[model samples]
Target: QQQVKQSPQSLIVQKGGIPIINCAYENTAFDYFPWYQQFPGKGPALLIAIRPDVSEKKEGRFTISFNKSAKQFSLHIMDSQPGDSATYFCAASIVGYQKVTFGIGTKLQVIP
Candidate 1:
C-alpha cells in the first residue's frame, strides 16, 4: 500500500518567499516522519524530521509540522532562494523497520 501521499506536484516561488509542501500517511504503525531534499544528480538527503511525540520541529530555514491524529505532516521553507530549488519528499517509517515509504515528491523552483 502506498501509505504516503504528497501534494502539489510542483511549485514556483520568488526569492525570499516561503514554499510549503504537505504529506499524509495511512499506517498508524509509522512512527517516524522525515523530509528529504534532493538536487539534480544527487541522492536525497535528510532535511528535517519529527516523531509523533513532537508536534513540530525547525532547523535553520526549514520547519516541519506534524499532526499525529490526522496522520499528516508538512514542510515549510523560509526565505527560499533560487539556490533552494530542488525536489522535496516526505517519508514515513517504523522505528526499527528497514523499509521507508516515500511521498510522490514536490519539485520546487525558486526564481530570482
Candidate 2:
C-alpha cells in the first residue's frame, strides 16, 4: 500500500529561485526520510536524508525539513539552477528496513 503522498505534480522556477517539494507519510513506524533526485536516462541518486531525531538537515544546495510528530517532510532547493532541474521523489522507510515507500514524484524545471 502507498503510505507516502506528495503534492504538485510539476513545478517551474526561474534560475536562482527556490523550489519546494512536500511529502507526508501515513505510517508512524517510518523513521527514515530521504529525497532522491533523478536526471534523464539515469538512476535516482540520494540527495539528502533526515531521521526523525533531526528536525532538519542540509547538504550543499539541498535541505530536508522533517516533522516527526506530523509524519511529514519536505525538500528545499536553494539557488536552483538549470542543472538542478530534475524529477524529485520523497520516500520513507523504517530504520534498518529495505522496503521504502515513495511518493508519486515532482518534476521541476529551472528556466533561465
Candidate 3:
C-alpha cells in the first residue's frame, strides 16, 4: 500500500463543463490525500484535499471525492473555464511523512 496511479494522460473539458479524473492507490497507510493543479511550466500547487476520515472535500470550483475502503479518489472540476486549463496531479502521503508520491499527471484543457 504505497503506490497511487492515475489514468487518462489528458482530458478536454469545454467551457463551463465538468471534467472528472480517477485515481487509485495501493497503500491504505496513506492518510493525506491532495490534488494539485499546475500551469504550463510551473510547479504543482495544492488544489483540494481530503483525508481518509472524510469522504468528500471541495474548494471553489474544484472538488475531491474519496473512498477509504476502495483506496480510490477522484478530482472534479466544476464550471470549467479556458483559464482553468492546466495539468493536474493526484498525490498521497502518510502522516509524519514530508514526501508525497504523485501520479504520472493529467493534462486538462478547458476550451472556451
Candidate 4:
C-alpha cells in the first residue's frame, strides 16, 4: 500500500495553543484531505483543506498539528474566538466504502 504523501495538510500555529482533535487512520483508502463539519439536518461541510500539491494551508488563527508518517492528525483553534464555538464532527472517508466513519461529535464551547 502506498503512503499518503502529505505530512500535515497546510496546518500551522503561530503561537502556543491547545490541541482538541486527534485522528489516526490505517486504511490506505482513507482520505488524505480529512476535514468535515456537519450540523443538524445539514450536509457535511468542508472547512479548511489543502490540495494535493500543497503541504500547508494557513488561515488566520486556525491551527493544526499533524504527523503523516504516524498517520495521526489533530486540530487546534487559538484565542477561542466566538466563531469557533460549534459541535464539530471530525471524520474520515474511505474511498471504496463511500462512507464516513466518525466518533460522536465533540461539542466545543470556548468563550474568551
Which candidate gets the maximum lDDT versus the true structure? 1
Write the residue-wise lDDT of candidate 1 on 63-108 in tens digits. 9999998889999999999999999999999999899999999999
Candidate 1 — which residues are off by over 4 angstroms?
Answer: none
Give the Cα error of residue 2 in candidate 2, in Å.
Answer: 2.5
TM-score of each: 0.97, 0.96, 0.95, 0.59
TM-score of 1: 0.97
The lowest-lDDT stretch of 10 consecutive residues in candidate 4 is 2-11
- Give the alpha carbon lDDT tens digit for every residue of 1-112 in model 2: 6699997789999999999999999999988888999999999998889989999899998999988888789999999999999999999999988899899999999999
Cα RMSD (angstroms) for every candidate in the order listed: 0.7, 0.8, 1.5, 7.2
lDDT per residue (tens digit) for residues 1-112 in model 4: 3232222322222234442655565664555445555555677676665323344555666554555566665556656554455555455565566766564455555454
Looking at model 1, report the run of 10 residues with the lowest lDDT sum. Answer: 1-10
How well does candidate 1 score on lDDT at residue 4? 97
For model 3, the run of ten residues with the poorest summed lDDT:
1-10
Candidate 4: misplaced stretches above 4 Å? 1-19, 38-44, 50-56, 94-97
Q: Candidate 3 at residue 8, lDDT?
A: 78
What do the candidate models score in CA lDDT, each in turn? 0.94, 0.92, 0.89, 0.52
Give stretches of model 2 more than 4 Å off.
none
